[model samples]
Target: MPDRPATASLDNPRYYLQNFRSVLRWVAGHHADLLTPQEAVRLAQFEALPEGSQALLVRMVMRKGDQFRASKLSYTEIGPTTVALQPLVSQGWVDPQPTLSLAQLFALLTRAELVRSLQAPLAQAGLKRNATKQAMLQSLAEASPQPAPLAHWCPGIADTVVALRSGPLFQRLQLMFFGNLHQDWSEFVLAELGHQRYEKLSLLPQSRAFQHRSEVDSYLQMQACRDRLDAGEAPAAVWPDISRSQAPSPWLESRRARLLFSLGRMAERAGDSTLARQAYRLSTHREARLRRLRLEEQQGEAEQVFCLVSDALKAPANAAEQLGLVRIRQRLGRRLGKTLERLPRPAAIPEIELVLPRQDSVEMAVVAHLSRADAPVRYVENRLLNGLFALLCWPALYAPLPGAFFHPFHAAPADLDRDDFIARRQTLFDDCLATLGRDDYRECIYQRWEQKQGIACPFIHWPTLTRELLDLALGCIPAQDLQACFERLLADLRAHRSGLPDLIQFWPASSRYRLVEVKGPGDRLQDHQRRWLEFCLSRGIDVALCHVRWQASPTAECET
Candidate 1:
């Protein structure tokens, strides 16, 4: 590691401010060309904000919390007044009074450590955790008004509660970091499970959500118990009873199977063979069955284990499970057929590049060599980001194009599917194209980007980019290609923006580009990567998946 500068210290508040400056300089130095006139103005105004506001801005940019309490902002370095944000407020850069409710707070707390620390009952005969949480919060609220301090449970509870009640979330993240708060359907849906748990109802048409908050609480408690059992820490006196619980849908069943699998692992780690097998036998999850098979093999209970694995094979199997099944079959010496031909290679095939684990460095090296050779060939990884940049600007050019809704920083619609998106693409593309055709579209893009004019927006990762690269993306890349990629990305923004190749080889003179996804040895295509590859193939996008093999001495591991 490099030596730290003598002047740098976490104790100094100014160090944070200096970090803010460093971040701003990086953004300015990289995306300056992509910035529209209005964006430049907005960014300049942000830089000139009061020192405290600047500090607060950096705080929001760096953390997961959306809203912040005025009290939390009442520090010396950051101005005491949330009202200092009036400039930002007027420009829609900040929502000073975002709405939040008690129900929301309870939902958030159920998953939080405070509830876990309370040693709260999961299945209290007829009661749910939601009821318990609300009752507790009600007590706190009642206590709050009596001029007595409420029992503060955690370090950040007061700040969190205050934020939930009336704090502001810096909603206009695209202006600051070119993205919005974390907004993915999976995350939102999973978090929302707490709400369904509170309501004690199943979100079956929904997934991840459960009928009881106790369901989650019990899972959490069991996980804790498992960890404690493994680490030799003391556990709570009581535990949640899974059998006495209400009838479970498949999702809950799968979740419980996972928990049982975890318990089996903990028991195995603790050297409790009987307890481990009991947990394993109780679980429907395939991995648990595999472990049971192993244990039964060790105990010379071959018949019991074989019957168990054979029954387990009835359930749906993913790639990993299938591999496990194959391994178990091999262990039994029954795989004397074509199944052996389909097995994954145990080592790298010596036919590719010279990277061992990952090709990130090799890809960069290859691209760097081409760049140095000056063959008009440059590596552009974010050839896709340009498409995102264009999509983000659409709402500005076509006011009705859903700028009131969609933006780059924001995730695309959760309910929206690929077919629906493609069906509506014509009208959207027309409006965006119309917007881009005008000489003033530049101003529109800038204003929208500056003011954060949409609910759904694009997010840019600023660190791995440069101004020259962005310029090349916008100028040298073909507009048609950008449009094609943008349409594909919109088909399912959650799924499609990923899986792009590690590097792109671009010919500036011919405006031609080829994608190269470098793989080292045992690397295989992930689901998302496969999705991207399929899209590229269908669209005639020249893409190659290159596998690399590493040559190393037998003592390489010892050397390391």
Candidate 2:
């Protein structure tokens, strides 16, 4: 017989082949539904292995289940048909499952193999609790009718058997184990397994079922109170009264405090000072114990409560309350300021100009129409013109821009003296207005402003030949262009600087950067403008867009 081939040795080939066949049979019988067609082929290949290797294959598959259960995978639904078979390859006990994607199977299999090895050390190190051990064994037995031979070698096997004999730990272990196993099986398995276990356990007649009716009612009431408060209603008023006929319990007192706080705020809104004070005082007294408890237990809530008390005291009619409120407010403000100071300051504004086209002709017409009815059109013009001038005079009103002259433009005069200067300024303003009205000019200005300066002009209004002209002229523009224009205007003023004292220093060397963009409500930046804004951002420029509503009201005194 050729001395019996070396490949067929009993210790190797025959042993491995027999084990492999057994594993194949076990898998087909227990997990046939879980295996894909491709996986089924791979499983068959393992079945063809020598008996010695077959035992290793069975161990590998079993390890995969143990690993899945260990990692809390049992919490998720796992179908029997989709059982991953790659754990065997990871153990070096079997060749890689050839019919399945190697990468997909490697992770799961590797985890299982590693966990199996770790389990021995973990148990020996006393990391595996007796209850955990029992739960694991019970899950194993339930999963497979006959435990694999490898189970005998597990370090905690004896301890697990002892635990299964009795006690609360045993029951808990059984619940956790089966809970996880059912999760591995299917979604319906959890409910089914739970029901079966309940019936079996119920036979003991000593097991107590949990009741949640009172707990659920408490939660519902709390939620309803929160909902009422969120909707800006007084929760105490909206919630059913539970305090009048009965002495207040801790719960009722807490509810009362919350209600009182809500009522205080409502009273304050309604301008009922006496009622508001009464409500706030009631809340403070009712929550006194809660305040003390919070001080001892919750630092955050204690501080908040202190703040609320202080605020109430500050406005309190009595001297004692006022003093207390003042001190508390000051302390809180100091702490808040200290914390705020630790935060980083905003970035400095970069030198840039945002330009938008002038569109004030129609607006100017409306102003002119409204002013035309008035005896003095010049007064209306002067009011509008002065408003623009006042804005330029205050550089701080518009930020990020270093000065008001950040945009290259000149303001219309409060009053023009020389016909020559007036004509020149009027012409310049008209040219800008006319150009802004044209689509091409408007689009170009819009794109240029957005890209270079990051601004967009949506619509135009005209105040007059003067006010509208000044507004358009003073609006956003490229910084370099603004500088050039300022220089030219200054030169022009110096040459004709004699007659119009009002136009003195048209280009103030003290000029600071100021940029502002106005849009109607709901208006947003245009696409090209948005792109330009990105460009300005990349270059680090300061810009702001504001929605402005223009209204005529009694004018205030001028700053200068």
Candidate 3:
């Protein structure tokens, strides 16, 4: 027998087949203990097949559907289609005769093919030859015909359809390989074709995503629940599948928390406050407790709200949650007629009022108006801080810790946004951030900027991160201030990653900078943006809120 190809190359005619085999080998090697008896037997059976048969099976599996017409099964490298398929049929991997519903038949057959096959039915229904495929399907749907073999549906239509019986097995193997269903066979092809490049990490045998078989099962179950919720199923209907007991894994627990939070939001939208409260109470997601407090306050449960808010304020998850808890407590205090200690109000954001000629983008107008010879204003928004953090912390972010780097094609860690993301790599991140205290931090940033340029990162926008901007940022923004901003980002990556000021004005000569948030006519600061502005102001950062008004056009003025 030929040795399995060491690498997948697009130049090979059977690159997809090679990729599929690689996945099987990878899963068998890494997840052998997790495989069930049936899966083990199936894997052995698949290996026992001839090369052509294996290639044929893989080709069918990679395609969208399980069923395919023999005429469509034309791969030159796999030799004769029937010759390749015979072994698959003998091994029970492909069903030569399988039942398919009318819907399935409709999907398989073209409109013209349908008319030719179902001529009698169409004629009986008095439908025109020019009738749409949809019309024909709708007309036939009323008859409720039983599912039957393709031959029965389209008798002697010069075609044979075969169904691959092991799509679910392939799916399970893929989940084991990729650690998620969102990525599929294309990742291998993309990597081979040089469309995307990933960091090379030294993976140990124990570094696989799933330690126990139950994690795989739980992931699939959670995925199904999410799918049902997305398909417009009621929260109450999907609630039973959400396991009340927590999983031992932090990543799995995070998935459950996020799903519960989603279900709670859905319930709240549907006006099921009780169900929403139940979901929120059970969820360990950062926003869940705050949402629950808001709901309770709405339902006239002020005392309960106060108790929960007080407990939460003692050890709030992050700044956003802490800020929310304080507001809830203040409202409850007002209602309960009790004086409470208040958090010192953040200094008001300095405002700049601009009345300018109407422009398409208010931000650009502000940028044009604020630009000067020595002091240049650019629309940096959230990019500058995010890019710098990503560059400085590349090592920490891409650390090949177990359960983080499952595959070779990952753009970012699987748990980058998870609650324990920072906790897992605290030491590495601390080492990376410690540079901010020293002078070599600028060189470290520049080195990463050059070496890892254009590499896929969650935070870095390579297209917009120019050398001039980098120089300006390094010179103007103090290391202490960058450290503070980065610390806040690490504190709550998901919540604090966005809502930065729209623009930054830099005085490179003086090594000074000011971050500006722009608001157009009738626009107000969003809660998240306000939170960010408050954070900046509290840290003694130079930031301002700019409100712009559009001057009336000549035609508008004449009409008035």
Candidate 4:
């Protein structure tokens, strides 16, 4: 088998990956009625595995549930090394592979997570428990790779599941599309509850109590509604119809908010202004309010929005929110001479020391030339292999918010010690970093780049990433810096990851780098982006937020 950069799946790697991704997408689109977003994701990941890995996966999968003992996966067919499976494990195609250790479990604990993990009796007894992680680290190594039962291994390929029959609604959907239900209960529950607390949602045979009650989730019930709407079903037929016997208690709080929000969206799309307005008023979410305001302007109900803004102006607001109020007043009543509050003068920060690019893709064009003029530079927007690298190096760092896997992303626990975080992270990184970076640290990232770009990709795989882009990113972005940057991103992805500077330029020959965030005219820094800029700039990472001002629109004849 070829070493790290290439998988043993196929000989013509590029052609195979492209064709496979295309075919997967085609199947997903054609069977849109038959799959959930998560199920479609599983199909792509499962098909991307190497033939040997696929065979080995069948062995492990046949024997256990979603996350079985990783120790059971050291098979002869896959490879001589268990590390070969890390790509699958890292990408979340295989539950990010857990290791058995006390410290690892500790690293995953939040106080909320801790309280939730143990009962009141046990919590009280163990709340004061302590350990020397550094001392514990010296003696421990990764749990050894154990052989899966060779007897359990099936000889030939299993029957290709083409159609799904015996199952629930979600199951039937997955079977028709991806051939299996890849979503586990944890993920399903997480989706249902969102950032709220975790509670299992199950269906029971309808009873007198359940006549007006809903044991099933509102979101789950919405599936068929969305499916019908997408299939060109009329809005009246597609919207859920609650029977007279059904309980009014089912839609409460957030459930009510979600239903009203969904109703407003559907009503607006169906051109029912009256119904949309009613639904929008009942929704508690800001998104619903914004959509309603936009709709009001569209339907000549601007007076309502104007009244809303006028009444709400007594409270504090941001510049963006204030500007929105200004627009509402300006456009109200269609009187050209009618005046409202003047627009606030937006702050402009001049970049006097630097010469900004005039090119449309200033970031890309500037960096592409700078790479040639000086050294290598690469654009890593969503292709954050370094972030994945950090995760791959330390799966325990996933430290999901106590039962948070089934809901929206949340911040890591605040009470974790800085030394402890570094210690736990370094301990995990140390386990494989040496072997991965033995010959060249650049190859370490490059190998992960291959995995992320290859079959182990978790999501809808990106358009084929180029070798030149890979080479420069691997060759330039320092591996040493990857851990620090990724740790910060993970520490608070909501704040840190998005709004990052667009380009990272590197002078590999001199071991130097700079981060550049390019902004078009009239674009100011977002709050989250400004946080990243401040963090990077304070750390002396040479980050620049470049706001581009175009001199003039280039004539088509002068276009490059």
Query: All models: lDDT?
Result: 0.48, 0.33, 0.88, 0.46
* Per-residue accuracy of model 3 over 215-280 as CA lDDT, tens digit each: 999988999999999999999999999999897688889889999999999999999999999999
Global Cα RMSD, each model = 18.5, 30.4, 3.5, 24.3
| TM-score, prediction 1 | 0.36
lDDT for each residue of candidate 1 in 53-157, tens digit (9 for 90 to 100): 666655555545555555555556656555555555565555655544433344445445535533333333233455556565554454332221112343344
Per-candidate TM-scores read: 0.36, 0.16, 0.90, 0.40
- Candidate 2 has its poorest 10 consecutive residues by lDDT at 198-207
What residue pairs clash in candidate 4, if any at all?
A: 190-406, 190-407, 212-247
Please give the TM-score that candidate 3 achieves against the real structure: 0.90
- lDDT score of model 2? 0.33
Tell me which of candidates 3 and 4 scores higher on TM-score: 3
Q: After superposition, how far is residue 232 of candidate 4 from its true place, in Å?
A: 1.7
Candidate 4 to truth, TM: 0.40
Two-way TM-score contest, 1 vs 2, winner: 1
Q: What is the lDDT of residue 403 in candidate 1?
A: 17
Please report how far candidate 4 places residue 535 from its true position, in Å.
Answer: 10
The clash numbers for all candidates, in the given order, read: 11, 35, 0, 3
Where model 4 places Cα greater than 4 Å from the true spot, the runs are: 1-165, 169-217, 240-263, 284-286, 298-304, 310-344, 349-365, 372-375, 382-397, 400-402, 406-499, 507-514, 517-560
Task: Give the lDDT of residue 331 in candidate 2.
Answer: 55
lDDT score, candidate 3:
0.88
Better of 1 and 4 by lDDT: 1
RMSD of 2: 30.4
lDDT of 1 at 271: 82
Please identify model 1 stretches exceeding 4 Å from their true place: 1-262, 268-315, 330-351, 354-363, 370-501, 507-560
